[model samples]
Target: MLKSALVFRNAFKILKTKYLPYTKELQKVGGALDDEDWDKIASFLPFRQIFYDSTLSFFGSRYVTGNTFVEEIYDIGYRINRSIDDLNDGVKSMARQMKMKFDKY
Candidate 1:
């Protein structure tokens, strides 16, 4: 019973991560700069192609160059996402193997 419960818990953890938010690239495309210097802002960001409209106005470049709150949040998001992905994969594999072993009985 304890093992089965643990398996269920593991399954839940994996499901959580597989459904986590993933939009760094998507959000970056809608930013405020057409990039007379694309390499400057986007080289660090996780994106392949950047798109900017005429209505966009480039900022004075603070998020990439300071200890700002937005930067902190972005850092936290990336860290949390990585850790959760690792944890989730382990849990899911464990759950699957446990179930498969039990099914033979």
Candidate 2:
């Protein structure tokens, strides 16, 4: 979970600083990204091509390569962070329950 959070943070940072500004122009391409644009996106992702292909497959044919790719990244990051927060909250709740049980004993 920590590793995922770290990776998410890094990826989101890169997306915000780098690719996000180009969102309009990139989307204008209609998923016909050139090599340079592709390289820019792939450079920050772990497992580069595999990650891209898997995301495309999971999210549908062109989610990763489509005009909304940048937006997708943002959404993915938001989901990941939300999941992490939920898990953390669950853990904290469990810990509190355990403490209450021990205190009663």
Candidate 3:
């Protein structure tokens, strides 16, 4: 019970520190976000690493005797998903900027 509670607490901390800033800033700026804004968004993660915070959060769950096939597959999928998410977010911001820039012409 305590472990679960601690996990939840840690998850919430990760959400606030690692996830919320980018989203909140995006919302706050509407579509006028700039490169500096994205840089600030990226800065939330340690060393700007993909899934660094999330992977650390699951440190206790890492394989002790080498990962099973299922674990290996899940890890692959998780990494792909994280990469896609990061790309998607950045692309969305860039798309907005492009649209706004072209609109002025």
Candidate 4:
């Protein structure tokens, strides 16, 4: 949730600094730019391309991989939860070890 928020905030910043300026310049030219022209302008902004690619990959994977994409996301979530569980277990194990060592002394 926090990560998504940061991504949106950064995307907005890029839009403000890069894309908005280009758009204002286009408006000043006194005519509407068509889809193709807008695409051309967007292509020149490297950050826009990167942002679009990342966002598309996240939401478009389903279109490319069908149902497997959903399974993949579930697997990733499970692994993350497992990793947190393992870390917690490790801390308990270490505390047990310390307790045993002190008891022996």
Candidate 5:
């Protein structure tokens, strides 16, 4: 419960810092959204949705199973999803590379 709360808090911070600024600035300009503007906003949605989904899954699994192992597995799945996401965003981190290598084995 407490862990999920922390995750939600951090997610909100990321949304505010990384996403809200752009939207707010656009609104302030009173301009219609061009395709490029829409594309920029759409690009962030998948990453944000992943965070929300992982948080929900973490808490949901805990309540349903009450098993630490299950929770850990869920966490691992989320980490892998996040790594793939980062790779899609052009971030070739060590973890993402390792995941890709392991997938080929």
Candidate 6:
């Protein structure tokens, strides 16, 4: 009852903000987005080219033809995805350890 209403309210708020599914605006002057900053941050995205404002909008769900999305929750999603590199590194280290053991045998 009350709990469900509260959950719904929170969900709506998130949809309105970070996880809006798509953004249709570009970086504005002295705003949250800019060329230099986009270069620094957007690289983490899978897109080889980055676009801003309305230049890349209206494509909806399949914008980049397999363009996956991150929840831009102030970088939480980014942080999680980035851990993949670290995980790969860990696996590589373990494989090296196993190879060493096998060589000893």
Candidate 6 similarity to native, TM-score: 0.19
Can you write out model 1's per-residue Cα lDDT over 1-105, one digit (the tens) per residue? 333434365454454456444333334576322223333333323221111211121253434434553454454344434333333454345445544553453
Query: Considering every candidate listed, which one attains the maximal TM-score?
Result: 5
Winner on TM-score (4 vs 6): 4
What would the TM-score be for candidate 4 when compared with the true structure?
0.23
lDDT of each: 0.37, 0.47, 0.47, 0.47, 0.54, 0.38
TM-score of 1: 0.20
- Lowest summed lDDT across 10 adjacent residues in model 3 is found at 42-51
lDDT (10s digit) by residue, model 2, range 1-105: 433544455565456457755655556656334445444344333323334654775578533555466565555444433333332454345445544553465
| Candidate 1 total steric clashes | 0
Poorest stretch of ten by lDDT in candidate 5: 86-95
Q: Which ten-residue region of model 6 has the weakest summed lDDT?
A: 46-55
Deviating ranges (above 4 Å) for candidate 3 = 1-40, 43-63, 68-73, 85-105
Candidate 2: which pairs clash? none
- In order of appearance, the predictions have TM-scores of 0.20, 0.24, 0.22, 0.23, 0.33, 0.19
- Where does model 4 exceed 4 Å of error? 1-63, 88-105
TM-score ranking, best first: 5, 2, 4, 3, 1, 6
lDDT of 6 by residue, 21-47 (tens): 422332233333333443433333332
lDDT winner between 1 and 3, please give it.
3
lDDT of 6 at 24: 30
Question: Candidate 3, 88: how far from true, in Å?
Answer: 5.0
Top lDDT model: 5
- Regarding lDDT, does 2 or 5 come out ahead? 5
Each candidate: RMSD to true structure? 22.8, 17.6, 14.8, 18.3, 10.9, 19.1
Q: In model 2, which runs have C-alpha deviations exceeding 4 angstroms? A: 1-54, 57-66, 88-105
